[model samples]
Target: MIKVKVSLRPIVSKINLPTVVKTTILPGDSIESLFIATQVGEIFYIGNGGIRTFLDIRPRIIKLGGSSGGYDERGLLGLAFHPEFYYNGLFYLHYSVAGTQGPVAFSESFKPNPCDPKTLNQRWINRETQYDHIDTVEEWSLQSNGQPQKRRTLLNLRRPFLNHNGVNSLNFSPETGKLVLTTGDGGAAYDPFNLSQDNMEIAGKIIEMDVVKNTFINNPPVVTRFNELPAPIQETLTVMAKGVRNIPGISFQRFYNQYIKYVGNVGQDLVESIFSFVHYKPIPVTQLVQASLMNSEPNQEGFVNFGWRGWEGGFPTSTKGGCSENPTLDEKTIAYYNEAVNTSVSRLKPLTSYFHKDQRPDKFGGTALTGVQAYMGNGIPDLTGSVVFSDLARVEESRSPVRGVLAYTRVRTDGKLNDFSVIETDYNFGSQSAYYVSLGTNLDQTKLYLGVYGSMKVTDCNQGTVFEIVP
Candidate 1:
């Protein structure tokens, strides 16, 4: 399997460098935190408690300030933490905004009136909340005198692509804790006046909500708003499953003790995925609405169609079947032919893919799988149920076997996806003065006690570093 067409070059060559250490759990105050989505718009919260104490790390922005708040696409993209998050402080975000002045065509439906005027086939829905701010789901609380207690939006999005406001990721359901949203495919390319494969009312899918049903006006015409809050806690978006295309990441795979699994991440343009949310566990929803209203094929149930615009990750549009190795077929398993052409749109065969093709000149911007973390490290004894992934590196080029560092695993408890290793490779570490190595456990057991908060540049400023990954 060595078919060559090589032209990908970006070499500095230095290999094997993993032994970092510069720990900060609450030192000088920095309770380990780092979540970013920055083109610079704003979704910043570097570390340590508020009243502003950023000794330095570049992003401290988190807006909602006057003039009805502002921050266009606003930078910050996605971050999630709330399985119970101790006791519900719940968090979820996705940005990009600045379109109320009105008139911005490309529609099949978008009537909210900015002055109304859109045409991709007619689009201008905003009457105030055609979907509102791409996507927002908040429920914060920490004001014992510590700030941050006024964030309650719980699902809001009306974004028609300023750049795929397909929201990013928010996963929860360690077993019916209920909350899984990975939307995208509501934009980019087409669905133009069709509002994403025949509008089910709101853009491109992968939604499932019920963080404990806030009644949502008793699910009114598909949940509108529950008596404007104060009905217990209010939160409901129950749409369980739907066709996906830009699901940055959504996860859950426990494997022992009553087994629970659901994982997703697909973004076609060269086929990219991780899927196995068991197509919403073995069928039957009136056979997925009689295969979406009186048969049209594509195995209905919960939905998992990884092939968009004819095929990307599964190849075919020809750049040599989208990226080489042609001769008909040579990879085998394309997620079992993207669930048999997403449950019967017919014409199977196209799942297991991992092609590189000179690493990103364009193929919908290279191997996408932005973020995935599931390694509950108490300090890795017998490797305490492993799973670690973060590939936010979108082709800075370097033969991309996943640029920079971090990729680990253990997956097996029936959801099967095996060991495959890389442990951790350096991304600089806390050096530049103050960022240095070895902390927490050791004496023999290999080594483990890693907890690192990220972002570093130093001299020109882009700081914030909390480290430790000893061995």
Candidate 2:
């Protein structure tokens, strides 16, 4: 057993369900500022040597949940920066709103009251049926002072329910120059609506969109809405990659001549997995589909389905069935299993599996595996090419190696995962469960940020925390 030593430093505590900490550089700045977001709809930053509010959409968030909603899985979820941020003062955000709005047009004054309790705090609650309808991707341009000024609505996801509606792993790869969208299997247990396997639905999928060529000139940052996009782009965005329960952890690695994108998809009852795709170029979805179509291929083959309801740790016998919304469509696993390994298709397999039971006998930890990043910095050579990530779970502070927060593994050239180890095991992150964890950036990409989502995995206005991990 290889023992790993690390440290977790406190950057800011008492955050309100901190989901992600994003960093970007501006011109004439000695260092980049870190933008932190809470599930309650607040965006703040540590820049210009001071902490300030970058943007706040709390007033507009529908069904804005807190502990009262039993630890809502929604709210302001992820953020990103333009590649040329120093040149263009722009960034992007992903947040959920009441589907009751039903993918409406963007309005400058469209703020509406949501899940009214007249106030927000620890005791907040909203029904999955009540608050979640449409989750959106938005672009914002900053004023000269580094605060957001204007907003543009990009992709609008008119979702099915609230649970798992939180979008994450929002990233801008300098290599691809496009925004990668990570969505969950459209809420409810077992992907109730079958959104994950729907070719036109954007749930439980990995989607990419071009940001340079698609927006309004006066508005600044470009966008391609889900409905308005070309067929190829839309098809690329949704291939019905059934079985992707919810992919939260995602990061990119560009080695000598290969660009590897790593993702950790969380399973419902048993399996937790990490998989990678070698996407060197920002390939058009249309082309991949066109080629497959020209060759007469099944969409399932090209996309990997990790078997959400169909397969689990104890899959064959003790498997959980499909979601409640459409049970008949997912009745049994005969066709599902055949679809997963269908020979005519180009199915992707997991590098390794973290079975709930021992997570494959060599797995490090279990449950709520949120995000993964392949160590790309030279500061830590041993960690290079290794996948580093955090989990979402509440554990006894005394349980070392984190009862369920952070861990890492190495990927051999053959795509097999090496030994897994817990990071910062000696440190106590919080009694709260981690809703999300991601890599952070400084002058160098040498640290990771753990956003303690708070107890019960919900955002408690006063209980959430954000911690910084260092070598």
Candidate 3:
């Protein structure tokens, strides 16, 4: 048996709604690089035990103080460093914004005229009833010693409803130097618009773009609903794969000849899971894959679709059913999804998934399952090959018991994942509330860091925190 013990140790403290965090160490760096994305829309750079403003986009983030109040999904959601960040100083952030104009369309409906409540009941939703947001990816470049300048827009997606827009997660291929991004099927229960299954829309799929060129490495995803949508929007998205659900974080596992990417996807009600996509170079070498050329774009390689909204189980054999957490499962839709599962040409099952069963811990109710990462750091021998992940449960309000999870799975082979287990389950931080949202490897890939969105909030001091998982 592969034995391991997990503990959370504080690294960076007092952050605001800490959501996405990343760390890196280059060959020429004197100090390790630590960067974090806050739900309130600020990316901070920490080093030598201090926090510095890497970039403050708070002014642009759209946070609607409604019935949900401070608890929200809108804000900066993802952060990533260019593969060559050390030399290029380029990075990207995923965030949400209010539409400057009125409602754009049905898929992304909205008219933010709070100043004039008279202009209401415009469309399918009332301005007061729904607060809409547009998810955006902005690229920025940091010079030798100056402010991080916004380079250009990489992705802008329209998000309807309040939550479940999916937790935006971004990472660059260690081997190919390409950007791999996972987006939640557009929000609203049952995916009312059916966007997750629609390939034409980038709303519910995994997309790959050539960040340097700011263009898709390939054409728009050839999804089932290709013919339904307007040709213009169809041509806009560059999908890498389809049938993806809510994925909050992803981690890379690389060997001498193989580059494997793992993404932890959250299920509706019954289960939560982790899936992987692998890319292999034709010729295996001692070193990693050589940055290759592709169809008119840089490093444009393809990946197999890890089926979502339809399929599950490389371990449980095969699991199926409803798309959302909604209790009612449409017979027709369920049948169609089962058919798709049987006939899917490119469906890949999950690495592991935990079901809500009797005798399971209350925390097993994964209202939100966020990150899945294999421990590749050499610092801890026991964790070297272990797959680590996190969960954010909405059912656990700030006061009832504890919140979320930060756990790991044991990988059995080079490809498949079997044992679904937990590393740390006891969570009680006293006046300091403990919740897990983001998981990442710091510089040198030796330590695992967990982003804490909340820990008891004391007067004059906010308890947003980020922690390192030590074995």
Model number with the top lDDT: 3
What is the clash count for each candidate, in the order shown?
33, 13, 2
- Which candidate has the highest TM-score of all? 2
* Candidate 3 positional error at 257, Å: 1.6
Once fitted onto the true fold, the runs of candidate 3 whose alpha carbons sit more than 4 angstroms away are 1-3, 25-29, 65-67, 99-131, 214-238, 280-303, 312-345, 358-363, 394-400, 414-417, 425-428, 455-461
> Which residue pairs show backbone clashes in model 3?
432-456, 433-456
lDDT of 3 by residue, 1-471 (tens): 354566677777766767777775433567776777777777777777677887888788774433253456566777888877778888877777744222323443332222333322233344332435667777778867666887777556556555665554777767667666678766544344445654444666666655655343222222223333233433333456656667775677765688567777666546677776665221111011121212132222344455554543332112233234666663122323443555366566677777644255533555567677777777667667767778764353345645666556665567655756556534457654466767777644667878776532211235677787765
Off by over 4 Å in 2: 66-68, 98-131, 215-243, 279-345, 359-365, 378-381, 394-403, 428-444, 457-459
Candidate 2 worst ten-residue window by lDDT: 104-113
Model 2: per-residue Cα lDDT at residue 428: 55
Off by over 4 Å in 1: 1-138, 142-144, 147-168, 171-180, 183-205, 208-235, 240-246, 249-270, 273-338, 341-355, 359-365, 371-391, 394-471
- When 1 and 2 are scored with TM-score, the better candidate is 2
Reference-based TM-score, model 2:
0.76
Residues 1-471, model 1: lDDT tens digits: 111111111111111111111112222332444333332333333343332231221233222222223322222344455555435444444443333222223433332221222312344355344432333445454443444443555654545444344423555555667666666654534333434333243444555666554543322222222223333332344344444445544545455554334333344434444444433532322333334555465343444444343344345322212223476765332322323344345212222233333343322123444434344445544344544443333344534233322344454546544433434343433333221111122212122233222221111123323223432
Candidate 2 local lDDT, 108-212, one digit each (tens): 221111232221111112322333456777778877775676567666665555567544547786566777777787655545444554443456666676766
Better of 1 and 3 by TM-score: 3
